[model samples]
Target: MAAGIMLFEQKGFSETSIQDIVDMLGVTKGTFYYYFKSKEELLMDIHLRYIEALLENQKRIIEDSTKTIKEKVFEIVYMLIHNIEKQGRQARIFFREMKHLNEDHLKKIVEKRDLFRYNLQLLIEEGMRNGEFRDDLPPSIATLTVLGAANWSYQWFQPDGKLSDFEVAKHMVSILLEGIEKK
Candidate 1:
């Protein structure tokens, strides 16, 4: 599965063949088939694992009673960056190769993605209720602003870069909660 994910990340998903995975693992076709019915199934497994992990982490952050909503939001962003640093390869494959999954698989992935969005929105709503965030702005817009900035970090953020994940999260939180342009 790791080998398949690596291949999918390096090479485009459409370019990767089931034979490539079996050959890379030095296993027989029967062995590969025993584990995964098809390459699509393998990709789905990767997506499922990634989403489940992220959801678990988010749940932990949300359920932490000690933290303020502001703190929880920052923690969520930091967790995202931290997880990406820990699983850079899998994250790459999970995000980039998702398009290769068929319609049914894509639908399920979309549902998971929506769950993430909904969580973000809930955080925004909580912040608004608590007067920690700008209540004038719609919750959806704030949620998208926060989520978009955090999610797009995967495109440019380098784990080994000068700034740590928490640092990046701080920057994002500043821009998101504090706004970019001066008051």
Candidate 2:
């Protein structure tokens, strides 16, 4: 799968072939077939693994009673940014190659993605209810805005760049919460 992710990241899903993956790993096509019936199935596995791990981590963040809603928001953003550092190729492939997935696979992945967004939206709504975040903005929009900013980081963020993922996350969360207008 690592080979597939690397090749997919470099050559794209449609461009990548089962032969490419097997050749990269120095394995037979039979080995690949043993695990995945098709290349798309492998892609589906990647998508499931990525989103499921995120949901699991998010469950932990949401369940932690010690953190404030605002703190939870920061943690969630940080988590997304941090993932770029850990699984940068997977992140890139996830966003870039999703269009290749079949209808049923796409539907399953979209459901998981939407669940992640809905979970964050619920948290934002909780913050608004508790006076942590302003109630003026719609929670759905706020959730999408946060996700857009963090998810888009994969496009430009460098793991070895000047700014660490933590710092980027902090700045991003600050900007989202505080805005750029003068005080």
Candidate 3:
């Protein structure tokens, strides 16, 4: 899986071959076949593991009672940005190569993805109810805006950049909650 991820991240899904994965690991073709039916299956497993981890983390943050909804939002954004360093390849592959997945695989992934989005929208609705976020923004749109901004960070996030993930997350949360207009 590690080899597959690295190769996928470096060379992309369509470009990387099963032989390349086995070559990286010094393993036989049969060894790779033993665990995965094909490269697409391996990619599916990798994507599933990544999204599952994210959902679990997101749910955990949502369940924490001590933090305000705003704080939870910060944490969720922070988690996504922070994961760039922790799970860079998995994320890049998940976002970049999703179109390659077959119908069955895509459907399953889409279901999980939609569930994540719905939960996020619910969180925004919760914020609106609690007056932590503006009620007039429409929870669904607000949720999509927040998620789109945060999730798009995968395209540009850098572990070695001037700002750390924490700094980026804080800045994003500020703009998201407070807006660019000066007081």
Candidate 4:
């Protein structure tokens, strides 16, 4: 699966063959087949692993009673950016190669993705209700804005760059909360 993620990121999903993956891992075709009936199935597995880890992390963040809603929002954004740093190739393949999945697999992935987004939306709505966030903006739009900013970091965020993942996430959360306008 690591080989598949690397190859898919480099050569694209359509260009990556089962043979290429097996060759990279120095494994037999039978080994690949034993785990996944098709390359699409392998892709599906990768998608499931990525999103499920996220959902689980998010569950922990939301359920933590010690944190304020603002803190939870920052932690969620940081979690996403940190995951991108740790699993850069898999994250790339997840966002870029999802179209290769079949209808049923695509539906499953979309449902999980929506659930994540919806959960974040609910969090933002909670903040509004509790007076942590302003009630003027729609929670759904606020959720998307936060997601869009964090999700796009995979394109350019470098773990070795000046800002650590936590710093970047902090800056991002600050911008979202404070905006760029002059005080």
RMSD of each: 1.3, 0.8, 0.9, 0.7
Local accuracy of candidate 2 as per-residue lDDT tens digits, 56-122? 9999999999999989999999999999899999999899889989999999999999999999999
CA lDDT for candidate 2: 0.95
Local error of candidate 2 at residue 101 (angstroms): 1.1
Which tens-of-lDDT digit does each residue in 1-183 have in candidate 4? 888888888999999999999999999999999999999999999999999999999999999999999999999999999999999998999999999999999999999999999999999999999999999997889999999999999999999999999999999999999997889
Instruction: Give the range where candidate 4 is weakest over 10 consecutive residues by summed lDDT.
Output: 1-10
The C-alpha local distance difference test score for the whole of candidate 1 amounts to 0.87
Which ranges of candidate 1 are over 4 A from the true structure? none
Ranking of all predicted structures according to TM-score, beginning with the best and ending with the worst? 4, 2, 3, 1
Report lDDT (CA) for all predictions: 0.87, 0.95, 0.92, 0.96
- The local distance difference test score of model 4 is 0.96
Sorted by lDDT (best first), the order is 4, 2, 3, 1
Question: Given candidate 1, what's the lDDT at residue 58?
Answer: 92
lDDT of 1 by residue, 32-130 (tens): 899988989999999999998999889999999999999999998888888888888788887788888889999998899889889978987988898
Error of 3 at 101 (Å): 1.2
Any residue pairs clashing in model 4, and if so which?
none
